[model samples]
Target: MNPKARSYDYTKKTDVVHSEILLPKNLSEQLDESDIELDFQRIADLVEIGETTKRGKMKSSARLAREWVLCGVPELTRAENIELFEQFAQQQSEEQGVLSMVFVHDPTAGDDMATTKAAAEGKSMAAPDPRNIHAHILLLTRKLDVSSDSLLSLGEKSDSELSNDERTRPVVPKKLVGTIDPETGKKIQQGRGLCSNSEWLKNTRKQWADILNERLEQKGIQPVTHKSYKDLGLTFKPTKHLGKNASIAERMGVQTEIGKYNESVNRYNHNQLEQTANSGITSSQQQIARSQRWIDAISTGDAYIQRQIEQETQQEKHVNSRIGQGVRRRAERQRPNPYEQQLKTSADNRKQRATELRERTIIFDRASERADRNARYRKPRINGVIGEVDRLTMKTALLFSSRRNESSSYTDRQKDILEQFANENSLVTGDFREDIRVTTTFFSDADNAQTHKHIVKLINDPEREEQNHSKTSKFEAESDLNKSTRDYVDNESKTSNTADLSVSIAPRRYRRP
Candidate 1:
């Protein structure tokens, strides 16, 4: 036998003779033994109930232990604990002589009861001893009672309701242990446990904040504020309210309160600028109205604004043009026509007659001046006189009115040409020189030749449309030639620059490795 396995004397030499062996002082000279065996299987039944029960479930170790103790009580049926006790006995037997110490046996077999009863009644048995059995039972019972009492004192709870002790209920642990973020001090949610990754948590909070902020903005609220986690009972150092970047829900809560204040302020100031624009009474008022129109027009979206601006600009231009036309007509009626030498009846009639008379006088003056200047140097010719008369008449018509047209019948507009010529020639040097005063000049020979050529061309052109077409074609050809010349010059300059750039970069290839 191993020396370490040697048995020791359980009853040692006493200090006071072991205090008389602590013998029973009861009737029949027998010690009173606890009849309860405190089987762990019965205790395990209570544990199972605590683990799976819909109500009063065990959450703490103390609660779990109390539940086990309650299951092992005599109130539970012994038949339900047969297998539990057998397993317990099997495990205990494996321990060095522990089964013999407790005298464990299946209660259904009714064998260990007799031996246990005999030993309790002061008889010998194949087990350790009746006293040892009693001690084990007492120890197990004490442990159960302690755990149950502790749980009761701590006010174990399973629901929202509080226990008699008034202690706060503990939250159920989804995980055993988890790391919390130092910054947030909130339990980080992890896939492995209850906490998550710090970055993920932050992102989630940010997303939530964004959503909340959007909702608040939709309701016309702004400027959100929320306390930091530290202020809200977290383990991290305290921080100020999340003034600009709080989660949406928290921000929204604050925004709702501020929105009322903003609404009142807006209402009070509503008419300050907007009202002035709507009241159209004075020049300043009209200006304000116009400004508001521009603002209102622009506030509408891009497409609407573009259309409105175009329409308003066009309308204003048209109205200004009509006013201009009216002014011009009135001024024309009031203005003195330069050719008119004769007086008229009414102011309007005088103005009209003055305009007509002015044309006739200008025509006469031009023809006479040309004829007198020519007659002094050379003999008169019919073609020359006709050219002079025609040129003078064209000048008078062009000068007097824009309404005169070369395309109309000559008879209709030729009266001014003949009458002015007759008036100029009617003043003879033989008797009357007063009518021959020259105040203006006439067209020169080159101009006259050019005008005659143009008139001849108009007369020779068979198709009216062909004449216009020829003129337009000449104009278009000239314009195209100018554009082409510009393009050719630009292209040549660009090509030269590009060639210069290519030549410049040619040396750069030598620098490569």
Candidate 2:
């Protein structure tokens, strides 16, 4: 619980099912405190000495009320908890005339956070253990005076704070106790606070356990302990209580120092319990052996017991194997593998670095084939060939966003890939620069303009059926797409052409073993 929360937060909390202002037994009978009229806000103002500024507001460095969420028996209902709080408050707190406000926090399976933001926003950031049933008790250090006939006056700081020597002496005895100032001739205690001694705190815990046990026993439930394993003479370490932050971390499956410690403690306690159980069984067997006659123990009975033990061992082994496999499977799937994460990160980095390096030098290499065709028959315009050579000599990264249209060296999605890379690194896509394509050439003979024109005429002309069909068949056989490309040497006579086509295809490479 955050101590800085305002008094109104108690009533507004989603976890808080019911809240009421509680009075001491004597005051409850003597005074007529209206439940409808009284609230946490009014009670807080009455307890603290507020300021006398414009409208006499509470002064100084922010008024903060400390909050303690007293966890009750989970089995207890909201009403039972409120009742438990009343009994505990009256008996343990020594609140003779103290007015206290107790809020019963009853949460659902989906609950919950109690801070003002969570309550106001109506959402839970950290899903609490639904089994955790608790209460919030707010009591003022100042006492309610019953001496006044008409009005109940909020008196000086209660003896509860004064009783603790640690709070009085070192912290400021004169101000806290309202001791008369020698020079000012005034007794003032604007900052009234409460702090319990270690003995009192221990006693309060013991009392809580006692009262909780009483409640549990009434419902026929097993009573739990407030004492440590050491105090109870058990061979196990006690777990430390995880506070808000640690609990949130633990719930999120994050390993905190306290959470790890708790896990080890729980494991040790479980093992100790198992050992105790085994010892009990052994002790029972010894008793049986001692009680039995010598002949009864020796032959048939011993053999029967041995057979029973062997069967049980086999059955236990089978069950344990199944459980072990299931546990291992779940751990593998559900547990975060650090090595797997590291490898994934490494692979991503490697791939990205490789991509960047390729795009950086793509101005040079083409290993895997593009266009799915041999480059032997491509032809380029005289101007385009000269322009490409000149552009290469400049040795600069060309802007890649507009370069994908160059069908020769760059794929259509080359731009998208580079843009994605740039976006990932928060670099501008337009600034992702690389020059691969020669600007005017196409990658394939299918991109040839004359081939497209000839195919269109073959399909459209109805009169040239015989020529079209004959040529279409021949074209389909001898690379239909690249048949009779713009590069010219007579088909029968292998002679060089007089002039070049506008688009260039790479010259055929000789394959060698």
Candidate 3:
């Protein structure tokens, strides 16, 4: 058979028998060495029969005692050491309700040292069978009162500040101002303050509870309260548990009931300690969990923040680049040009003005020619030149001709017409008429009246006309018509006087009259 698969059963008559103890090397070495002698028989005597000798048991009674000695031993007798260890176990049970039997069985004599130290530190070390180590441990396992002084005093205790100079510190009672009697000048200890209205009374409850808690802490008692100081200050209902007699607590025996209430309160607080211990996680586990959550949250938040910052930076860079490009383009296009727009406008206006001036000058020249042609300063004239025959000569010539007798004998009307024409022609014999007629005929082609007047003034000088028209024949032709008019009148008078006497003498030869 293989050594790893060996099995041995030891029993007798259907009752389980004790198996041979197999100690580890260190325990065997201590058992064998004379100098490290241990009282295994004595340890067996201390244990209950079933605890040490039962078969199929995981640990034996003697092994338990031997394990304790193998670890570092404390400066205590075997029995005293066991009692100290038991106290630790009891303390653990009272504080944490789930009793840890494994902690009690921990194979370390250093744990015994801790128990002995706890005794010195004013913690209970009372265990069963004070002379025997195993019996004392067994009695502790059954039940024991564990002193909590060491645990309660784990942290630094608050100490009242002491006056360096020996003057007494004033002790003031916390009460409303109106609670002080005006006449007696003392606090009205019997009743509530006059100013203890609803608001003040609400706050007074918390003030009272704080005073109570503070006073209790002075006497080494911790107060356990569900309501926070802020809640208590607002509203506190002690009467729900105390009833209406709460107002007259002393006379109604409610004071005694209140004292019992405080006692129960202390026990309840102790119970709460155990409850809280059971519910709380170990310090190491709590710290690890809290740190992990915080790290996860912070890492996620930091990554988001970093991404946002990077995005903003990228956008800013893009915007800046665009702005820079725009500025560069503007700079490239920049130039100084003379404003041709205004110059073009001015040139256009000047050209238009020149065109208008030319048109105006043409109009003015036309108007000047028209004014010269129609000049108002020229004088009128009448004359007996070839183009302007003497009006009287023409008229006389027409009358003396035989055609005048055939048409009609000269009536008075015809004679008047002939005379009127002679008068108007200025042929009624003015000194100026012959010169005017000569000058008028000379200036007939002068287009304007003013030009006619100038030429007439120059040429109509009597001496100039005589010099200009020196031929006498031009004057004789014009004078013939006037001489004929005088002859015809004389002939007409002789014929009328000779009548019939001269008829036979032959009608005198009729010449062209």
Candidate 4:
């Protein structure tokens, strides 16, 4: 019985009998009542049941009893079935160290009353069935500690009255060791009570089956196994267990939903088996064809085909070996490289230096332009803007100041800035002097005040008197080249137009006359 409260109703079962107990025969004989009160009292005595304290009230809802229904084959005699159950109960008591009360129940115990009813219906009494001879065993959850010959001292008393060590001590024997509590990260202390071990109930079921099989083997009967249909390699669908209500309805010739489900499962299993059988034919043909190919390959003994196969096998082996080596080499190359790290560091440093220099150059150029516009010596403005003449004057002064300090050794930052600027303007050459010259010439001509200021700031500061030097020297070279090109083009165009005009005038006068 599960949900174990159901075991309380077993006292109402008239066919139940107590055939086994751990106590002396004198004490056992004293318990003769066949009622629920006697059954509860006996169970409480056997397990030494105690009350649990809950909300300041003493209650006892803990499991005090467990029951099992043991059935035997119809081939076994009534005495043989009883002997089998007795052995099973005794073994369970010895292993678990708990007391178990066994009872043999006969389904035909009230056959006389059943026969009288059948006669009233004009039916004869049916023969007794051997399958109805089974046993019911009620097991105690607590182990017995028999300290004295008296049965009253056999069970555990209240744990509160015991010492701390004694209360913590196990009531049942430990069957396993080294088990740990997952939540606490500590070794689990076992030996609490009977059925506390998870394997206890499972082992009990297997133990009963083993004992029953042994008895059947001794009687020269086919042994019954406890395994499921799948475990026994059977393909049939198993039926579900019918509970009390369903069992009663079935006995009264009432069909149930479980019966319909079982019928459908059986039909499905039959179809699956048929499909498997049909597929087996195709599988057999494929197997035969494979065998025939093997036989032909062996009988023909074609040297060319055999040699070709051997060569192909060797080629495949070589290819696989090469591929494996290539993979290993690639993995090695993917590892970090020290030389590449060093080169990357060097490139990063150069880029950072270039960025700083470029920023400084822009700031210096902006300041120089602002200072030139505010200078008192600047030319008077025309239409609220300074003429190009004043801009040229500032450029000439800065250029001369830079040239004066050209002999000074340049810092690494300054050198890098100039080189980068040259590279950007596509003016770099193998000669350092020529590269600098071309870079400066482009900057001066393009009105790049930023580069010009950066260069002047890198050199020594010029005096105020240097600004008054004639601007004639800076414009003389550019002015002469421009004047020569403009005079040549004007002279050629004037000569050609004069010749065309004279020819046209003569033709018009001749036509008018």
Computed on alpha carbons, the lDDT of every model, listed in order, comes to 0.36, 0.52, 0.36, 0.53
Query: What TM-score, to 2 decimals, does candidate 4 have?
Result: 0.38
The residue ranges of model 2 lying beyond 4 angstroms of the native Cα positions read 1-12, 33-37, 50-68, 93-96, 109-127, 146-153, 163-196, 272-513
lDDT of 2 by residue, 1-513 (tens): 223334433333466676767767666665664322456666655555332234445445432232456887665676787788777766633543566667766666223553334557764455666667777776666666655445555665555545564344334555445777688787644332445566556666788788888988788654656776676555777789999788866665678999888888877765565444334322332332343333343324445545655665575567556655765665567658856755665575567556645653452233212211222222233234333333321211222233333421233343455446435534343322212222112211223323333322222221353465679888787784465663332553443232333124547679997
Prediction 3 global C-alpha lDDT: 0.36
lDDT of 3 by residue, 1-513 (tens): 122223544221121111122223433443455343324343333233323334534333222221211111122344443344444334333422221231122222223433354467876543212222221121112111122331111111101111222113233365643387678897544222223234433443444345445544554433324355345332222322443244234333335666577657655643443333223211223333454454454445545545655665575567556655755565456534335544554575567556655765675566555544433221111111221222222222222221123333334444354345445533333333333333333333324223433222221222333444456656787689778987998888878768655676765677996
Candidate 2, residue 462: lDDT: 19
TM-score of 3: 0.17
Across residues 1-513, which tens digit of lDDT does each residue of candidate 4 receive? 112232244434554433655532333333322211235465564343343333433345555556878886566777788888888877666654556777787765544334455578886555434356777776665554433343433354322223354445455335434576579787656443433233444566788889988987786654556665575344668777776566544544567888778768867765544333333322332333454454454434344345545665575567556655765575576657756755665575567556655765575566555545544332232311222323232333333323324432444445555456556767656544444445445544424544454443333222211332236545787799899999999999999999999888875435654
**Better by TM-score, candidate 4 or 3:** 4
Model 2 TM-score on a 0 to 1 scale: 0.40
Per-residue alpha-carbon lDDT of candidate 1 for residues 106-176, written as tens digits (9 for 90 to 100): 22332444345556788654432222111121111111222322220112232212232222323335562
Worst 10 residues of 2 by lDDT: 436-445
Model 4 score (lDDT): 0.53
In angstroms, the error of model 3 at 160 is: 34
Alpha-carbon lDDT of model 1: 0.36
Please give the range of 10 consecutive residues that has the lowest summed lDDT in model 1: 15-24
lDDT assessment of candidate 2: 0.52
- C-alpha lDDT (0 to 100) for residue 503 of candidate 4: 85
> Each prediction's TM-score against the native?
0.13, 0.40, 0.17, 0.38
